[model samples]
Target chain A: MSDYSSEDSETEFVLYRNNPEWKDVTPVKQDDGEEPVVAIDYTEAFWQYRREILKGLNKDLNIELDFIHKVILRQSKNYQVWHHRRVLVEWLKDPSKEKYLTELVLAKDAKNYHAWQHRQWVIKTFNLFEGELEYIDSLLLDDVRNNSAWNQRYFVINNTTGFTEEVLNREIDYTLFNTKDVTENESAWNYLRGLLLHDKGGLSKNKKVTEFCENLYKSGNHSPFLLAVLVDMCCEQINEGGGDSVYNLDRARTLCNELITKYDTIRAKYWQYMLDGIEKRPKRARVKRLLRAQIKHMDS
Target chain B: MFTSETMPSLKFVPELHKKYLLFILNGKLPNLESMETNRTVLMYFALAGLDILDEIENIPPERKESIIKWIYSLQVVNEEENISGFLGSTNLITKENRGKNSPYKWAHIANTYSCLLSLLILGDDLSRVNRKAIITSLKTLQLPIGSFKGAKEGVEDDMRFVFCAACICYILDDWSGMDVELMVQFIMKCISYDGGVGQGPELESHSGSTFCAMASLALSDNLHRLTKAQFTGLRRWLLCRFDAGFSGRPNKPIDTCYSFWTGGALKILNAYQFIEDPNNDQFVLMTQDKYGGFSKWVNTVPDPMHTYFGLAGLSLMNISGLNKMFCELNTTRRVHDCLKKIQEKWK
Candidate 1:
């Protein structure tokens, strides 16, 4: 992607993420006892391989070609990765056979999550599988938090095949989310009944989404985009009411409790979304904390 | 921690800063100190520079709220004559008796585009904008030659009007506003002997005109009429303009705004990738000033148009750590997002 030499330290960081010594610099790490990231060698090979692929000499660089044999695939946790692998299948020499084989091999290993989602994407993209619903009970055990797969489950149930109301209800509870519109409280109330019916579902569905948003705050996704997304879902759970708006506001207050401890300008956009999610009427103390946090953030 | 060095390539930050500030503070272009009421090609660079700097805070809150009021004043919808939108550049001869900010006549295509952009940049939701007035105004601009004249009177009818119309039509999110087939046909006729698009048929192919033509087409989303062969030729003509920066025509000295003009054309054509050269950073940097503003070239005085585009050129190269600024102006995503939101809300 650039002209910098393989030895250039700046260029080295692109591939040096997983190396033990460079751990502080990169968020990437390897599984224990694996080869420490060999950046210079990898970058050299990548450049040479890219040169061959770019100038009409060769097309396939085969970064992941014929490499993984582990049915237990955990390459990336994101749904985007699952989507890309499906796209990558088309660029392969024999797409249908090759991707199908890859899918089967992956699923056979420890019931892979994204690989399962890839199978769903392939099934959905090409319209191949007709009887996929027969296996939803078994597949839901792979990862309960695989919201994408569960999201797809609703799509499959609604679009692909008819599921009994009982099954849909069971699946929603077990899947950690129920497809109730947070926009209207009635939908949230119904969903609460459904979520309580399955697993250790102690809280109502509204409480669960709120708790889920709080748990996400435990991570560093306090950016405005994240809070905006969270509040939107909460608002959607109870559409356009001052009450739901107030409820979301309370949740936002809980989310930003650590403002004096940590918060800055770069993170201010996310804070704005958090405030907006409360329908722009935040707690006075929280407002004070936010102002102090923003001032300190901008000052530094 | 985040600095200009973290961008795709370094241009003159000082030059860029100076040019951008000039763009904001009413640039000193020879005798032209500032535009009073009407918007021009200059405002695109000016507003775009503000976007690049992430400094919407500099814009007064009421600028858009009032500008909307001002644009409304220029609209002559369903009048005695089919007088479309006209730009009121002079405050001297108008109905309103103000020495300041009165778009005192019918609106023009370019002003319509500028006013809308100014609104968007000011972060105003465009709910109050009169799309119909602008669209109805656009309908009256078409001449017999299939090209558009700027206004009903003696204004020049050429590629600039076409670009402005395209931008206006685009900003309104309505292609029904313009005669798309005729516009495409007219643009097709403007293809010069060199396969480059021009202002009108037989005019010399220029970077500014080429951008106007290409952007109009891209905005219209009538790109299928523009064949791949033409795109390839355009791609070639555009890439050849580069000597650190791009020129408007072949063998012409590259100017600063062509970074946007030619670069913007290349961007619309999806051919920006072929021109990304890491070695050319120094050439781009030459346009930069250590204090502020970018010049057209290395040794010139800095201004806003170049400043806006120099940053845009670097953005096309996907410089790391500049993602926030880059994503905001992401042409495809921004348009597509707007379109999707409208569809969902209206659906």
Candidate 2:
């Protein structure tokens, strides 16, 4: 049992009694003579009372959940209302309706943070990851760049226990297939990396992975997200020192320089910072000096 | 329907804006009726607006005392709960329950931060601040994972409250309340793969949380903890936020708020020079209404949040006639100057 009455000590103030939005409804007299009855709509007053109760953190369980549902319907973005709902769901031990509640809330605003957070809680508490991939797929079909949906997809895959090599490979293929036509979609690109990171074959050693990236690069799609990923892969390879020589670092630097000077002007300073980090690595010190001389000659 | 020559030229209305803020502070705003719990935050906006206009001296003497007293009334001085931070508003506190025994009273980290800042801005000596109790209360709100919930009974832990807790500690000149290493670890985990920080691990990266995390790091003096590669990634992600104005995330529409969120983050990272000043200024200017405030975008209603951020964005760009902002703290130079004096007194 929780202490609910003590929290409700702030209920001395009146609410919705003087709100101008609502008026006392008058009932029309029946044709046959009878006493005139008053018609009252208590929606605003009821909501006002519920809001005050929720604000005080009163735990009435079922009533609190109903209040939260109504509050969310009107203002889906209110964090406090959703937080109260989360507390209620945890206490009630029945999160079965949470999935549907989240779906309803998110139907109003797909990117509602509280709704997404609630859905994540539901998925974890109920192990509802089996059908999540398809749900994410439908959301992505509606808009490929829905990062919230992409984040959910990532959450489901990474947090759930069923992520096998087969699942990861299929996820990679899904990203590639969905992103084939878009010039630059950072969500799909990040998803590709997320999936690849989980693959046991590793990012650079995977034949399909390398081929997929090389083909995208060769197609003149110099997207910043794509270039950034490719450059990272090359740096990882050079750091491994698998007989590519220090020239591999030089090529990677060139790619980053191109990213700085040409394609991604927005992130030029970031590329420069990355380039400086590359030159300062202890392993690359010898080759970095030589590259500096080469750059000086080119500048001259 | 009108010709180009007949269109009214838009301009910032400083005096009318001051009056608008004062009107909101008078507690009679019908438009703000729903925000009863967040009246102190609204007070911050009004006070910050006046501070920006260099008109803080215009507050009448009695009004200043009442405002200070009102802020103190929202504080929870109870010893049993060990929660002695400021509540968001006194609307929840009634005449019948005005003592230390009121069970309805609660303190929020955000309200504490705002209360402290408002006091500092109003030139109060902060003698009334319960430094030890507030610090202890802050520690109780911290999770073992280094994040902070807003209050004891509030929602999940995230970067927003972490920033608020950091600000509270910074204002009190105390770092003992928080576990610095754990907080740093939490912040690092919040850094998304794309380099922009999220509210928490696995959440979508957002500009607001990125600002909060960066500000927290800056306040804690732990920004150097980020590796060279990590710093570059963060700088890259933040710079890429610019698309005419800025968006909180990768695919969202440009909003006026991210101008401050992303811009403040970039400034803290020391990469603000890359911001396209002219385009950003134009975008922010587009959100200005003839009525003396800035909205989230053109053709929308203006609110205190957007207005404050819009002014802050311009100030970041070295716009004339606006107060210079302390990027990490998100306060004006005047307020920071007052805080510096308070620090000197403490020393």
TM-score of each: 0.46, 0.83
CAPRI band for model 2: incorrect
DockQ of 1: 0.01
Best by lDDT: 2
TM-score of structure candidate 1: 0.46
Query: Model 2, stretches more than 4 Å misplaced?
Result: A1-64, A162-164, A199-206, A234-262, A272-284, A287-300, B1-19, B58-62, B154-156
Model 1 native-contact share: 0.00
Model 1 spans > 4 angstroms off: A1-300, B1-44, B57-78, B84-104, B320-347
lDDT of each candidate versus the true structure: 0.51, 0.75
Model 2: number of clashes?
0
Residue A123 displacement in candidate 2 (angstroms): 1.3
